[model samples]
Target: MPGFDGACTVNESVKIDHPKLVKLLQLAYSAEKAAAFAYIGHAGSVRNPDEKVAIKQIEMDEWQHRETVLSIMGQYHIPTSRYYEIKYHIIGRIISCSCYVIGWFMPYYFAGRLE
Candidate 1:
């Protein structure tokens, strides 16, 4: 949206094409799946019951987000990819391992950088 829009065309009726949305949704779906996996690993590694529960809840939220993206893909008649799912799962595991090695500060640092 930021890159596409040049000037503010509030009066103009511009509809984004299906393909762009589909691609964006697909990426989002993959990311959500990866995040959920990472959260599960993080939750498993934690000793504090409350923190573990919180991370698991976050994992559930990510799963729900994935489902939402899946629903949108269905509505658009876009096919899901098994390959991407497995690939992202592995990536997520790698991320989880990195976080484990870095400890709690890693997430916060990354969050700040991302923001």
Candidate 2:
């Protein structure tokens, strides 16, 4: 758990249990789950076999990240809401469709912006 920065991380003596932290963690977990789904959809739409494989790997990584976040939330005794999960799930699908239409330009665009 080295370099873990989220709530309930091992480095801190005190655990986060605030309502706001709970809500934020829930939102972040949902977003990570959504990203994983979107990556799957993007991988499906890609023509290049290598790109598809790489995207699938990324999707798996996202799922792992989500699990880690969920575990942290669990440590805080925070419960995840099904409604928010479903809402973000639909939004993720929409993003995936949009990525298909846009030829997956978002990654490149964001990379350029970040640099």
Candidate 3:
């Protein structure tokens, strides 16, 4: 390998031990869950069949990302933060409900901003 200095064998697994990095990943995990919840409402609110399918796919992708994040956390022996779990769940539900009242455009706009 170009950057290899024979420090360790390629088969050795690298572990992440940084607290801040782990915390950030935890945040991402929760955010993905929230986004998935929001997408549920997003998909339901839209009338177009194609748009519904697309939003559902996006929702699935968010869930997949959340799983991947959880797997990473497990590797690091990191648990999900309880406070964040509650906070984002509420935020996600709020966004989901708002999607219905405010119409489609604002939700799409806010989602873009969040990204």
TM-score of each prediction: 0.71, 0.74, 0.81
Q: Please, what are the lDDT tens digits per residue for candidate 1 over residues 1-115?
A: 7588677655443434678776677777877877876776677677999999998898898889889988777766776777767777777777677767777766534323322
In candidate 2 the C-alpha lDDT for residue 5 amounts to 78
Query: Once model 2 is optimally superposed onto the true structure by TM-score, how far is the C-alpha of residue 34 displaced, in angstroms?
Result: 0.9
Better of 2 and 3 by lDDT: 3
Provide the RMSD of all predictions against the true structure, rounded to 1 decimal.
9.1, 8.2, 4.0
Model 1 Cα shift for residue 13 (angstroms) = 22
Instruction: Look at candidate 3 and give me any clashing residue pairs.
Output: none
| CA lDDT scores, all candidates in order | 0.71, 0.75, 0.81
Those runs of model 2 whose alpha carbons end farther than 4 Å from true positions after fitting are 1-16, 107-115
lDDT over C-alpha atoms for residue 53 of model 2? 92
lDDT of 1 at 36: 76
Flag regions of model 3 displaced more than 4 Å. Answer: 1-16, 113-115
**Per-residue alpha-carbon lDDT of model 2 for 24-103, expressed as tens digits?**
88887887877876787788788999998998898898889889988888777677878879987887777667676777
Evaluate residue 11 in candidate 1 and report its C-alpha lDDT on the 0 to 100 scale. Answer: 48
lDDT tens digits by residue: candidate 3, 1-115:
7988888655444567898997898788888877887888888898999999999999899899999999878777788988878877887888888888888887676555444
